[model samples]
Target: MKAARSDRGSQTRKLLLFTAERLFAEYGVEGVSNRQVSEAAGQSNNFAVGYHVGSKEDLVVAIVRRHAESIERRSAEMVARLPAVPALRDWVSCLVRPAVEHLASLGVPSWYARFIAQAMTHPTYRKLVFDEAFASRSFRHCHEGMFRLVPQLPEEVRRERDDMGRLMLVHMCAERERALQEGTASPRSTWESTATGLVDALVGLWLAPVTGPR
Candidate 1:
């Protein structure tokens, strides 16, 4: 009886997380309440989200963690295959492909990219998501490898470009996902191609000459 109950509880938690991701993607995180998430998941108790996931912040983290785990595993594999002295494009591919691959694996109607785009637009949630991403060891390894190829960059320029690269990746994926869902034209036919374009652009962004602030 205890085992059966535990299984049911686990099922409920997964349902809530899945429902919340779709809800947040359609309606902004701040726009969706925990009660709505629980109710949307078909739970009689509107507090199911609270019981299983804690607060709104906790719910968001749970969703992020679920996807991050898959992305992290892919990243680890790519990192292991790095060349003895990896080029900038190689490191950039490591950073970009895992995410593109993960999104591709989800097939059509995948809400993660849009959901992430929304979370990143929120003030508090943006930091929470970024902090969670930065915590991935494989991601940090890629970051270090890419940085090593550009050690000549001033710290400020590097930081600026890093932010630009990250925003570009996130928004680009979100747009592609939206296009796929809406049956609109996408820049590339496949996620692999999308990653290629991002890697190419990021390589240029990093190698661009830094101009002093006016």
Candidate 2:
């Protein structure tokens, strides 16, 4: 039946995605090829990735979109609970928690955090993936709220802090994820605690006093 075929197609697509994420995470984005992804995914057809996901860039974006929906919804919910005038920490929490929360929901040994960290390292894919996140209305809402609460900052300082905050979040989660996967002890006992520590650090980063370049 049509429904049966549809179900099979969906299954194949999901398998391709799972295989690609793990491989891409282990190997860098540029290190992995479309044929390898399909082959590792156990597809008989070497062109399976090309057929199902088009280009590698398309695959990366698709993977980001898959996870972005959950993070976006959680962000929207957090935003909805905000007061008329929210604290800096509140807006920062909205940005930080949804991501860690989604990772928590995946249980242990999830590949997404590291996958994202690796994606952000590549020049072309970094902008591609981040642009995908920035396109989310919920992400934009959280940013607008966060920026409004902070002290008026020069454009350069704001840009600097933005990069700092991003690296902090991505690398922190990636480190925690690596620890969890290896069964090594983490600095924090749980994802919730990790997120709490991250929010604290980000608050300091965002609110830190800036000096002009000489």
Candidate 3:
């Protein structure tokens, strides 16, 4: 009886997480309340979000955690395959491919990419989400490796481009996911192609000439 109850509880948490992710993707996180998440998740108890996932912040973190493992594992594998003296694009691929591939593996109508886009754009949740999403060791390794190939720039320029690159990756994937779900046309025919485009663009962004002062 205890085992059965535990299984049911686990199932309920997964359902809640999925429902919350979809809702949060469609509506900004601040727009959706915990009660609404619970009710939308079909929980009789309006406090299910709190009971199973704690506060709103905790729920958002939980959502990120749910997919972090697969992304981290893929990143680690890609990092392992990197040749000595890997090119800038190779390191960039380590950052881009794992995410796009994970979204691909989730099949269509997946909300994760959009959900992450929303979280990263949210004023309050942006840092919380970003830190959780990129906290993996593999991600740090990829980040360090990519920057090593980049030409030295002023600290401000580096920071600005970092933001630009992050926003590009997050929003492009979100838009592609949205387009796919709505049956609209995407620029790339496949996720792999999208990764290629992103890797190309990011390489250019990081390597572009710094025309401004310093």
Candidate 4:
């Protein structure tokens, strides 16, 4: 009886999370609250807080874990396709391309990456940096590769290089959202062009010789 009840409860929580995930992706994470999530999720009572997944923060953490793991898996496959001895540019591109491609998926909610990036600066949710990839090797792999490719880059510059991929994702999301707005914005469904532009910008950032004066 207990195990069956536990399983059913877990299922309900997961459904609520999935609902919250899509909502967060569509509407800004900050714009949505627990009541809204519960109401939107069609759950009864305060089941989302400390009952199943702790607080909304924990739910956000859960959402990040799911998406980041998918990204990591996709990145691993792309990395496997690289040359035997991949260069810095190759590694960095591998790190970013999966995210760019995945964002193009219908599964991802609107402005998801932008909201994730914004979480980087948010005091309450900044731990997402670690969850996103800071402590992970796939991320560290690219960081080390940058040093190998551009050996002269200082520590500060190297740090910037490490985060460049996420930055690109954020910029792409923001640009696309802006382009999607009415009146002032143009109807640029030209995503291929925008993605190409993002790749070019990334390569330029990494390949630019960083040895000159600060």
TM-score of each: 0.95, 0.96, 0.97, 0.75
TM-score-better candidate, 1 vs 4: 1
lDDT by residue for model 3 (1-214), tens? 9999999999999999999999999998988999999999999999999998889999898899889889999999999999988999999999999999999999989999899988887777887787888878999889998899999999999999999999999999999999999999999999999999999999999999999557
lDDT per residue (tens digit) for residues 48-78 in model 4: 6446677778878877776677667777787
Q: Which runs in model 4 stand beyond 4 Å of their true positions?
A: 1-11, 22-31, 107-111, 161-165, 177-195, 209-214
What order do you get sorting by TM-score, best first?
A: 3, 2, 1, 4
TM-score, candidate 1, is: 0.95
* Each model's lDDT: 0.92, 0.90, 0.92, 0.66
- Model 1: ten consecutive residues of lowest lDDT: 149-158
lDDT of 2 by residue, 1-214 (tens): 9999989888999999988888888897899999999999999999999988889999999888889999999988988998888899999999999999999998877989889989999998998889887668988888888999889999988998999999889889989988999999889999999999999999999888887667
Better of 2 and 3 by TM-score: 3
Error of 2 at 5 (Å): 1.6
Candidate 1 contains a number of clashing pairs equal to 0
- 1-214: candidate 1 lDDT, tens digit per residue: 9999999999999999999999999898999999999999999999999998899999999999999999999999999998888999999999999999999999998899889989999899998999787569999989998998875887778888988998899889999998999999998999999999999999999988877778
- Highest TM-score model number: 3
Off by over 4 Å in 1: none
Pairs clashing in candidate 3? none
User: Clash number for every model?
Assistant: 0, 0, 0, 1
